[model samples]
Target: MSDFQCHPKPKRLTWAEAACFMVTGPTAYRQLFGWPGNVVKPGEVVLIWGGAGGLGSMAIQLTRIAGAIPIAVASTDERAKFCLELGAEGVVDRTKFDHWGRLPDTTDEAGMNHFHKGARAFGKAIWEILGTRQLPKVVLEHSGQDTLPTSMYVCDNGGMVVICGGSTGYNGDVDLRHLWMRSKRLQGSHASNFREYREVIKLIDAGLLQPCLSACGTIEDVGLYHQLLHENLHPSGNMAVHINATESGSTELA
Candidate 1:
């Protein structure tokens, strides 16, 4: 294997901008463009789970670039607005709604009812925003158990849900009837392939895809930022960590 597999950063992009694209860029590209069967056709509507975060930010831009309509869901109004600014056609502010339910030990009747109630309410809000005239053709999901049930419920018949990671929870409970009866598909994708990475790089170089960088710090601060992310206290968008292998110095973890 070659030491330098990726291309040199484009002259137009700053180090922060290039760094922001590292993982999120290719994943977003694969979700929208590199799906195996290409379920999301041009001009289709895509429901983005977190339009202001790393993956969702890139997904919104890619969705727009692909000539699709992006409907973004964010936890706050400011984040929703940011997603709109990034090209999402519609926004769902989750803070305004109460979608709550914990996984129960046994799918007991009461527990199952509670879970279904929350999922139904969430799906209703999505449907209200989308209206009967328009339903999402594809759902860009990664929140996993937190949103999968609703994602499957609200998706149009024959629509697809393409998931990458389970940021909230991985053990998702999907309604089999909605999936099998409606012929909807649930697909999983890992990281992007080499070709997908290059395709995203070309877009970055051509100025078609913009990097969503929120913050940048020296490698010394990597631990600090990692803790913030682990604690769910990190800010929205991508964070850049400047790595310099030649420089030798150890910063004590604070």
Candidate 2:
């Protein structure tokens, strides 16, 4: 196998740093700003799920750059603190809800009630976090089945939910009422196109975007990195594996 694969690296980013943001950075940018016809505008409120994770971390920073306010749903206290540092104006801990993003059987009335109950509590928490402010105008969603319902329900009328991945599961239950009655929109975004990706690269080179890499090591650490991610034990930031010794760079987040 080749020791390293070459690509056009951003001039301002060290090899390790570039590797850190390669996947998550462009994906976040596409979801929050670069998606055609789905731009997040100034003064809008955005809700970002997993706001401390690789994708959400970048999304939080991009939201700030776009002059929008970002609210984060974090899985842990440490992650919540990190989200705040990365520019999330408010953080809600997902652990508080027993089924924050889960849905039950539609065929069973009791199950449907249970799902709504959890969704209601989840929506209440978001509103309380924002106080009397208007509901979120955009939701940066990826945790599909677990959170899409809440994302649709909590967003303001004519708001949007831009989804990229489904870490939880693919199938999601969205209330058509929320879509048609409230005039809400659900937009699906995939990987960034060449032009969109480069836009974010420019932002990175200009120092407007920051890396959230929290761990890195040589090729020997590959197994460990996979273990961490596979087991969902990786920190809320990105991790990198250095293929070429010369590419070694500091992995600590600033």
Candidate 3:
């Protein structure tokens, strides 16, 4: 085998002069609203799960900038408050919402028995949150797991669900029958490409978009990083974590 060499370390990002928003805000805008069919119109309400996290915070601001009302779903009340500051028109308290009842109880045989019941309840809750029998035209799926079920439940007839991450897990039993019958579309999105990224940058430069960066930490502190991820003490309601490396040590960007 040939000898291998490690690459040089990149410069650390300092809190005093870092542009954390530059990365997430534009990317979120593209993922949430940049698709062909996912058009934004005035008076339209777009539901965004994980609304307080990095991508979610960006989505909220982008939605508002595009003149669409943003309905954000977050795990805590504090997150909801943060989302409002990011221009979310409405906030859903996921902690108060019944996730166990809304999602499939099992991926195996034992939980399948109650799957239909859970699916129905999930659908009803979605309808209630949307405030209409019709599905929302655009559903921005940010929390990969919790929002996946809600995506299937709430997408309006002929609407679209844009999925970005798999925080919850990939592969679940969705009621495809409903999707086909209703003509709803489920689309997956990943990190923004060059073109999309440039567009987002333009929006930021114009001051039409502002994404919140809530918490900041260092990558070297594996223990603290794991704890934050486990506890979900992340960007909720427009907050995001910024990991910064320093000569003294690593620090979290808040």
Candidate 4:
């Protein structure tokens, strides 16, 4: 009667699952920042600071599909290995490098000097991987806090840094002079629109974009979800927190 036979009701996904795809798939990959064509080229290395997270996991896969080498930076060795298994060409250990505030001495001329020198060294390593004396052409910023400056440091002249969330506090001091001089671009990306969303689903359905779904939890345990995220307990990759509205409870996936 109402085209029921031709168009049956589509399956509905839970909020957590939907959030996973929205952040990691084509919207972030294609529409929001217009990746592949907009961001990277074949053989170029795209450094994703939070490669093991939901959005970062998606970025790594998309970048690989787009024909670029994905260099994922993880907080630990286990996560780095996991990202490599998920298609990353290389991995950087965040723990190895010292961030701005995390410098040895909290306050002193020596500490400040060490921080500056560390920043330069970090920039140099990144540039070497990019095959130029400049930073990467495309830098995906997902770590939110500690790695923000790294994004600023590793970006090449005319490069773009796509800012998503600030898991860490957002405010910080950066060298703006280099940004202006290099003509680097800092762009903020959010969830994709309906059209892009559908495209992402298609990629998943076709098995072209396989994001790592690390963990799953029920909705009633939302507090646990936040706790895991805040504490960095969740494994690097896509972690799903499932909510059974009907049962009014949640459970973590094995």
Best-fitting candidate, scored by TM-score:
2
User: Against the hidden reference, what TM-scores do the models get?
Assistant: 0.86, 0.88, 0.73, 0.78
Q: Once model 2 is optimally superposed onto the true structure by TM-score, how far is the C-alpha of residue 30 displaced, in angstroms? A: 1.2
On residues 27-95, what C-alpha lDDT tens digit does candidate 4 reach at each position?
457522464434677776677877777777887888887788777778788888778887887677767
The digit string of per-residue lDDT tens for model 1 on 1-254 reads 56347566756777667767879988977877766555567778898998888899998988888888889998877788888899988788766654443345444778767766776666666667657456678888888987787788778888889899887787887778788999988989777888888788888889898887787788889999999877756677888876763332222211
* Model 4 poorest 10 in a row by lDDT: 3-12
lDDT of 2 by residue, 1-254 (tens): 34233345666676688879878888988888755555899988899998988889999999999999899998888999999999888898988877545556567788778767877787777778768647888899988988898898888888889999888889877878679999998999887877767787788888898877788788999999888877778888788877765635643333
Model 3, span 1-254: residue lDDT tens = 32222211112433411355655665677766678766767667677888887777888888887777788877788888888888877676666544443354445555554555555565555557657654467888756664576676677787788877777676644567778998887888777766666676566555566534444544555576566766887445222233553343233333
TM-score (C-alpha, index-matched) for candidate 3: 0.73
Q: Please tell me which model should have the higher lDDT, number 1 or number 4.
A: 1
Over 4 Å off, model 1: 1-4, 100-117, 127-132, 245-254
Model 4 accuracy (lDDT, Cα): 0.66
The lDDT per prediction is 0.78, 0.82, 0.64, 0.66
